[model samples]
Target: MDKLTSMNVFVRVAKAGSFAGGARDLDISRAMATKHIMHLEGVLGTRLFNRTTRSLSLTDVGASYLERCQQVLLEVEEMEAAVTHLQTEPRGVLRISAPPVIGSTHIAHAVSEFLKIHSDLTIEMIIQSSPGDLIDEGIDVAIFLGALDDTSMFARKLASSSLVVCGSPDYFEQYGIPETPEDLENHSCLVNWAIAPRNKWLFKGEAGYTGINVSGRMQANVADPIRIAAISGLGLVMLPTYIVGRDIEKGRLKVVLEDYTSPPLDVHAVYPHRKYLSAKVRSFMDFLQEWLEHRVSVIPPVME
Candidate 1:
């Protein structure tokens, strides 16, 4: 009782001018082709084909129905083709969210490079310290650092950056360098309040992991402010090496507690969970992964 299938068979039979020929083209038995045409005729309550011993031909009603069926089939084919193209080619506006420091330094470049390759795609980037609600914000992908808290979304690890506790040479000269994690309690540490365990920092020692509660005169929700404060000799700040690497190289900041390594901050691309991911989201995620692999040396060579 599939009306579309019946219509298709009818059109094939009409064009072929023989029930056997139509059945052969459709890979159906001749009897099944006759049955499909009969089913269509029953629905319309009109004869679709005039059959004689020697040949068969379409009736006036059959001619009209065949023309209409051809149109319908063509439209269905077009719809399918459009969907196929969407599956293969990435298009549409890709909404992304990321932390301000990472967004400005790394993601901005990646996005610019990605746009150069994908001419049809448009990008909207939202840079903030807080990881906003992806669904409410209509975010297609969220670039994140550290551990993922929300299990509802799908996350792919992009790269990992070493965490270093550093301060300006002038600041260290005044406040003195911390020889151990315990010394941080006495030092004025500029904390990134945006990250969890705001006043507390973790470090790995010879024994094991140690957590230290820190206090400072300055605190901010973003890393850039903390980084600037550290550079300006306001206080010591702990940040990813990617952000502080150049500063350290230039002697604007000096890392402390070299033996006590902090946990490496892992970067990830998170998206809402769905049965089928869109081509735009998938393509961008893949591109970002490859881009980070080539662009950032934050991750250790052993890990690579």
Candidate 2:
């Protein structure tokens, strides 16, 4: 029997809760289903399902293996689709959405480079203020920042992005550098306009996690404006390190709060299966996964 066929039979048995039920569903006899599962168990040397007279259940190992089995199946499907997509010479518009900072800096660069190679591709890049339902909007691909807790989507983590607390030299000169989380209150705090719980800036403190209530006269819904304001020495900004990293290095902005950086956020490229992935989305995701993992290094040296 084919390995995939046996695994498929085993998956059905585990899911349906009985060999008899699995056979009925797969249109095979119970004896064949038993043999198929027996072969799979013998090969792996683990009992996947525990059977009793009244009910069927999976053992601890069986439970864990089932999830892995499902993931393996999805990967196999994706691999086949990828081959098909590549062979088809993927020509079409690739619509991409991401947060403004990432889209403008990293993703946009990758897209431009990708177009150089696959010249037929065109992209509609939307720098979103917030994320939305991909399934609802017909969005081909969504480039997302931060750890994804959305179980509804399949997330491929591209990289870990760090945070930076920075202000203009003038702002820090006037207000002073904050060596600790407590010092943030003494200085003006600039914030992103769209962040939920907008008034709070998170920090990792010596004791544990802490959130500081911030008050600043200037705030904006996007990165460019906030960055412009910060560079002009208006107020302090706590941003993902990538956004201000170049400015900080160029001496346009000064980094502060070395001991109090937030935990890294995982950047991800996500999409709806959309039945099957088009060549455009698949190709770009492959590109982004590489770029974010290797190309972008936004972690600033621990502030001196």
Candidate 3:
């Protein structure tokens, strides 16, 4: 068996977390997948996976090796593309990572359109909260919202969405609208840990920028749940306009503190720094930047 082919199989199996799952992805028999693993173990003289009938997991060394294999395969793919003169046109698979809300909505739509233009390109999108280890997971690009914390990766600004503090009309009627950022203290303010400044909401007022350390009976890591809670009249929520735009438009939620403005959440496309950039990644990045800019260019302070 080719060493490179064995490495690819091993990576598939490791990611799938089961030989059957990996074999299914590769369109190979379980026996063939097992053979590939055994072949690699024999060459490396190390046990890559600890297997039981119920589960399969990578060993410490296997975890490290998986990262190396992904990098190697990526380089080989780039080299082949260059040799075939496909460097100018994207071909093969392009893996992406993105936050769930935007990933399923805007980013996914952009990818579908890009694929239409480049029929030879394939895209695999992983909707995840964090970017994770890009190199280890073999992700070509990651769509990030808000500020960039990791300075190691290269990033490009794609677009921005305004943030809004809102709640159900019933809740506002019952609790009374918060007239100022500081007035949030008197009301229940639902918090989403996923967005930056998490428990603290920021706003720009006559006194300049201020951050309010907010707390509520409800809190979540994702924006959707928080949005749902606000719609049900549980509490107020601070979320990006993209997540709560429709709700505001439909009157399921009402925007508050219109006099104050919050910083727009910046959307970014991030990827690991690589010396050789593949046409698939480079072209998609350029396309997505332009696509998102037009789509999310102007997020009104209130969807209405």
Candidate 4:
């Protein structure tokens, strides 16, 4: 096989995690997959994989090479999209990565609506936690919140969400309610690990913003569980307003320190900067942009 085919085989094997799996995905024989990998490794003079009887994994160098190879392959796909843009519609697999909560609460719905009209498009979504490296992870588009420090990537503002400091009404009633940020020092605080100051919850409002280091019996990295804990009267959790909106409205949870709430987190659709975008990427982005315009909120950023 040629270099492009070799790279394709390598990426498929790396993603599939086994020669048999890659062969199944590519509709080729396991023997052919093994031969292609062997040829590529021989040309490169490296052992790309460490294989066992039942499993396969990339070697350290192979792990790094797979990232670069996927980008190169994507660039080639983009070139093809540019050539076919006038004659063909955006119709291909668009891989997306997003934080679990955001993907579940919002993006998934938007993607479903998008697929209604773009019938030829396919979507592969990975629901990951916050603080994941998007480009190295090999995704076409990433939906996330807060500050994106990397200037090399492109980010488009999608929406905003506010942070809520609250708990169940029963919990507040039992704890006698926290009258000020300083009161949180003795309160049970549920921490979201995605927030940098793990012990200190940030609040912004009439007092011009402050960080309160809190002690709690519960802490988690994801919002779903945090919400559950708060609803069950576990403790006061500082979560994005969007995540806890219905809960608060339904009296399942209560909002506290509203006067000291922080500003909203800006949600963005981020992608690697490139000369051309594949049809899959372009269509997905356009659909997302249209969908986001409707969900624009004045609230603060969530766990992502």
TM-score of each: 0.86, 0.65, 0.70, 0.66
TM-score of 3: 0.70
Stretches of candidate 4 above 4 Å error?
Answer: 1-82, 86-88, 131-136, 205-208, 296-304
lDDT on C-alpha atoms for all candidate structures: 0.85, 0.77, 0.89, 0.80
> Where does model 1 exceed 4 Å of error?
1-3, 18-20, 28-47, 51-55, 206-208, 297-304
- Name the better of 1 and 3 by TM-score: 1
In candidate 3, what are the lDDT values of residues 192-295, reduced to their tens digit? Answer: 99877878999997787789999999998888888899999999999888788788878999999988899888999899976668789889999998877766
Candidate that beats the other on lDDT, 3 or 4, i.e. the better one: 3
> For residues 196-234, what per-residue lDDT tens digits would candidate 2 score against the true structure?
347777787778768888867688877678888899988
Better of 1 and 2 by lDDT: 1
Can you rank all candidates by TM-score, best first?
1, 3, 4, 2
Candidate 4 lDDT over 1-304, as tens digits, reads 6988988999998899889889899999999999999988999999999988887889998998899999999999999877787235777777788887878867888888888888878888888875357668778888877777778788778777777798998898788799888998988888888655678887765657678888788778778887898898889988777777777767888888877767666788888866567767777777787766556463323222
lDDT by residue for model 1 (100-125), tens = 87798788888998999889899999
Q: For residue 83, what is the lDDT in candidate 2?
A: 77
Q: After superposition, how far is residue 249 of candidate 3 from its true place, in Å?
A: 1.2
Worst lDDT 10-window in candidate 4: 295-304
In candidate 4, residue 61 scores what lDDT? 88
